[model samples]
Target chain A: MQDDANNPEKKVISDEEIKKIAQLSMLNLNQDELEMLKTDFGNTLKLFETLEKKDVDSVEVSYESSKISQPRRNDEVLHDNKTQKQQNADTSPYFNKKTGYFDVPPVIETE
Target chain B: MLHKLSLKQLHDGLKNKDFTSKELTGHYLDRIAKHDVNLNSFISVTSEHALAQAQEADKIIQRGEQTGMLTGIPIAQKDIFCTKGIKTTCCSKILAEFTPPYDATVIKKYQENNSIMIGKTNMDEFAMGGSNENSYFGLCANPWDLTRVPGGSSGGSASAVAARLCPGATGTDTGGSIRQPASFCGISGIKPTYGRISRYGMIAFASSLDQAGPMAPSAEDLAIMLQAMAGKDSQDMTSANIEVPNYLSYINESLKGKKVGLPKEFFQDGLDDKIRSKIEDAIEVLKQQGVEFVEISLPNSVLAVPTYYIIGPCEASSNLARYDGVRYGYRTNNPKNLESLYKDSRAEGFGDEVKRRILIGTYALSSGYYDAYYQKAQKIRKVIKEDFDKAFEKVDLILGPTTPSFAYKIGAMTKDPVKMYLGDIFTIPANLAGLPGMSIPVGFSNNMPIGMQLIGKAFAEPEMLNMAHIYQQNTDWHTQIPEKYTT
Candidate 1:
């Protein structure tokens, strides 16, 4: 097992890429945090780059819990406990009692 | 004396009228009150709730008909499990005020067995970091030395058990969250085979990799607690339908003629000499008990860390996308629109480590890079799993150091996230393979405890526990308490 864990070369994540990924992740990072992440992700990319050395062409993708051979249950509305459902909604901080939906800031904006 | 008692000892005391559950619970509560200010092990100490549960457990003992081993016993839970009507925060600000209407199957199991819930242990927020420094609650200290970390994200649970704040605690392991901390704290913890424990109501980290298990002062206590914890649940579709084995029946048995594989990859040049020597000493002890050690090779284990980081965060990024602030978690103040509600809420709520993983995950799973990063990592994961499968065919168990090194000072390795990622090389492979693994206190280096990891085949927790119990019977390492924690 060769330990090349600290090799920091061959892949440079650009600024536009960082902003795009953060947008996709739905996180708003400030300028300083984005700068730090660029460095961090650069190292992460390099760390993962070592995996390219392994000849994995013939290997299949194996999930961690592949051993759990469960039968697929019929997908239907299983919960009939409406009171329990309401209680669940009530546990949230922004649940609206009268509207019967979650409360959030208005989505559509118009002048 | 109460602090030193195992779970079995505590159960016996209650059954024989030697001590009331309230008194026992109070003993641990008093310890938490006195010591947790220094340890920062608990995010929220449920004293009133714990006392009430203790009263109920005491009543059940008085009835004395349907009581089980866990009845009248006090234990702590990692904040990740959702407790019905009680605040289950996962130690993240995102869900700091959020309560669930339904209890996690694991929590429901403990409640059903009449066990007392003492508190919610702190962790690396959302179970992200290798050290507890990433916790939103505060720095969770190793009881042995307050300045050093307890090797997280189960740092709080490990510290509580090792410091004797509680007789036992539950910890979830995605990538060595349980075993690494148990190693650092000089206690016993196990991550049972994946799917062996239900993950329902456990706030997701990496859904496929996460599994909950028990941590305690001794392997026998772990066996007892794990038995109560393990089972199939319909709520968790991934939870194994196989009947839970009687773990106790597997332990207290001889280890004569048992074959254990010492993976060559685990002892490569990178392992600290002091830690390596300690693992060798553990092997000598097992050898005396008629356990045969064979050197085996798992070639692809070298890539485990790199492979896991990609897969874990990719899953985490997808899983954490649920915290959009419109539903149950923290909502940002004065949101201008829905997009601001999602972005601003997450930005204000999640910690740095959590954000780091999410960013990496999103990038890996992105359109053009998916095949290069995420798919490549998954294929490598298969390579690592196959290595374990082959090793198991040659031997019944794989034994090695639980961590590459002993606990480092806080802030020492956090700056270099890659170095911190490499620290998990030994523990990551077991999680990658979904095999059952555990850490037992083997010896010490520089007054810090060393842990030897034992990885068993999938669904082979009984054999793993039997080996650990037999080793614990021969060694007093598990019984040694920190000098500071001793009254």
Candidate 2:
């Protein structure tokens, strides 16, 4: 048996690493949640580690394997302004909207 | 009584005036009210909307107009499909109250046929987990045993059908979501070739893997539903523009010279003894009908679960990036800053399983691990697909167990995510290969239903359904309903 495979603690992800991952994923987890995620991540990653042994050196990655591809249509307006306005209005409740535009936190800080 | 009828039977009944569409819809609504308390199969029961649609269907039938097979039959939509003016939560808190402003192409097709919409059924949150336990609403129990899961993330649709809540329902499969639940619930379902059904408004989980299909009591009923559901749409670029076959007409095709291949790896260790024996017996029944079985090898199929876990989560991480607090869905209240706003809203909206997959996916696609994890998994995915490609050269289709075992008790595999994933071993290869696969109730093992999977080449649903239909005609397993659910 491999030395690291037998040691359960060997793959334990650090708290800082988990925090960085959560940040990269745009998730804010509490300290308790972070600890739980670390253990869960460790277990799942161990399962994923089995892929390293597979021989895929000659295989090519496929994005879309389907042979049927539709020809692109000429660019034309499919929807009227009313439909666009309704769709815009639908998202008004989730964020700050002023004059049919979404309002967000300022990108730059000024004194 | 109306709930007991199949889609074909229901269509005939409506035409013969044996029952009105409104009465049929009312029967299912009453059952949903009476039994859904225990099953928790439905997220929202649209009685008023269903009655209104049924009344409209009755008018069409009265006018002596030619109508499709699903004209007035009641059906449920899996909550993942976007329904205009109806709440489609996907059983998650993030989109808990969000209503789509337009109908998904599948919903539009059913509505155009005037099929009564019973309700939106429950599912694993965002169709993530194999078991229904991951839903924000609550776990859905198997209608057969009540203590067991109905299998997910399409568990609610399967349970609702098994319990006679509706004639049929729509289900989406990424990795065995439809077929596993169909197997566990003793019903029938099919996951057509990837892009066979439009995914324009079906909420994305894994884009390349997800395909929507029908769930019903028998392959014939599924054919009836699939006739109405399959086709290309301009809204979804990935929807296949291939010829949609007349599945209903092909149901009675002879299986005399058809070839069915059994993957040697599928019958190996980890499969339950009883389920294996039942599948063997089912193969004998098909053999008597003159169907020939050839031994085939899918050597890389053993890697399906690992490959699926990597690719599924990675795509999910990128797809779910749209759920930030910017536009629609749940937003964190009073966020201090932009980063916290994105973080807190997602952290608060998503459940544990969803977060876990997001983390795994993000880590897989992270700077240092991309080539080792996500890219490598994709290459292995091609190998898995090739295994099926080579097998199809010698045989028309492949046969296997839908799941390795019968439905386990609710919460049994929740603690260990890997064990839950292992349950999908037999079903994941079809998704990886983007082939059409069906599951039909072959027999019972320990009083629980065992489903035998029939996988066909891309867009070969008619052939797959024909094989299953012939098997159903020779056996009575698909007609057997749970005693507790049957009145």
Candidate 3:
């Protein structure tokens, strides 16, 4: 790829993009983080500008592991140890005893 | 007497009855106790277990029993591996008190061979971050200079080896966790082809990219560890069925006509001049030894860090999801309900970088955005892999600097995650390609060490070892440890 200056189609990282990244990254950043990310993100995107000229089309992709699959293990019983109380206990601090399920604030905001 | 012997030297000494296994294990345990308080390379040192194993090894050797290549050697395992009765936190608060009930495949293999497990080393939480600074236990200092970082998530393993805390240690590489840290700390480490070592019980980072390998004092020693560590296992489906070659013997053979490629892209920009010069000088020495070098190109090489960000975090987010306040780990002190429990547990359990990557990964893999980012990056990942494959067809191995620069001061890139992520820039491509690669100390920039990486074809680890072994024979960088580390 050519440098960002040379690639006309490449968009300059903007505040909007930063917001999108923040949302994805689940970051609770202040204005300082957004501003700092502006430079950091730009540098990262700019480094990628080196990819524009190289033809990666002809290269063959590798499966990090070999393609051949292994046979499944026999259905043999292994050590199984757990009590009913252990399974049914209000195991999670997050678990609500009344509802018997996880509780979270609603993600959607009301108008 | 305690610090100078390499794994090979110590192994030979034990075999010859020059020293008992108890004596050797005691020596290492004593050194770790002495210097490790300042260096902080270990999370838990297994003194009691180590001595017991060492005594057993001595008995077996005296009984004329046969043992594997790693017999009687002391090795520190990265905290990511599950060690029964030992803390295996992956350096996160979530599993701080959790001891695994079973051993990881690699740990089991070591145990079977009677290799002494000296301790568990520290790492970046969930194997995130470039420097050991992300570790919740605290930052691990470079053995060479106390103020600087020993490049991380495998920082403890690298630091431990550099400081002679143990003969060698095992480290898992997701991106450049093993190689970059090994480079910065001036040690030898290899991230073998994925599946060369089983990942059955390793704390998952990026499952596709995660690999367990050895960090040692020399390429030849690394070979011995690799021989014991590499093989297929019924427990891990991803383990390869390829024949495990005798790596130590293979690396010592002639490399008269081997073709080496110097990728032009790795040397381009943002690289330290001193590191570049040292790598060039090393290449010159290799050329004199009759190893040929040719200029080559890996297009889309710059996309390494970006692709890694998407894939590694995406995998990490998924892998770490199991740590939800339920199964055998940290739970919030007080929570009104389950939602708060999950949120508070994670927020308190994970470090800043781990949280950041989890959020990033969760976002990328979430609905409505998977196509634009995750899928696109996977396609780009394929392109990157292909690029390496094509280059390997024409060259026996690819050589470059492990990181673009040397280890930076602690907190140098704390505010800049992107900059920290770039430390593994040159190293990540091999992970994406599923190829074997290694970092050997090339030379020092200022006082900190710089590393040169040797990348080989998929499953061509024997070739990579040969290249690193050949270079070490011609240079003294691998032999030079920090002055302060020696007693």
Candidate of highest DockQ: 1
Real contacts retained, model 1? 0.88
Worst 10 residues of 2 chain B by lDDT: B413-422
- Which pairs of residues have clashing backbones in candidate 2? none
> By DockQ thresholds, what CAPRI class is model 2?
medium
i-RMS values of the candidates, in order? 1.6, 2.4, 5.6
Q: Please list the residue runs of candidate 1 whose C-alpha ends up more than 4 Å from where it truly belongs after superposition.
A: A1-11, A72-78
Q: What is the lDDT of residue B57 in candidate 3?
A: 92
User: Please, what are the lDDT tens digits per residue for candidate 1 over residues B230-342?
Assistant: 98888888888889989889898899999999999999888999999989999999999999989999998888898889999999999999998888888999999999999
Please give me the DockQ of candidate 1 compared with the native complex: 0.74
- The candidate 1 chain A region of ten consecutive residues with least summed lDDT is A1-10
DockQ of each: 0.74, 0.55, 0.18
Cα lDDT of all candidates, in order? Answer: 0.90, 0.89, 0.81
Candidate 2 segments exceeding 4 Å error = A1-12, A95-98, A103-111
What TM-score goes with each of the models? Answer: 0.97, 0.97, 0.88
Stretches of candidate 3 off by over 4 Å are: A1-111
Evaluation by lDDT, superior candidate among 1 and 3 = 1
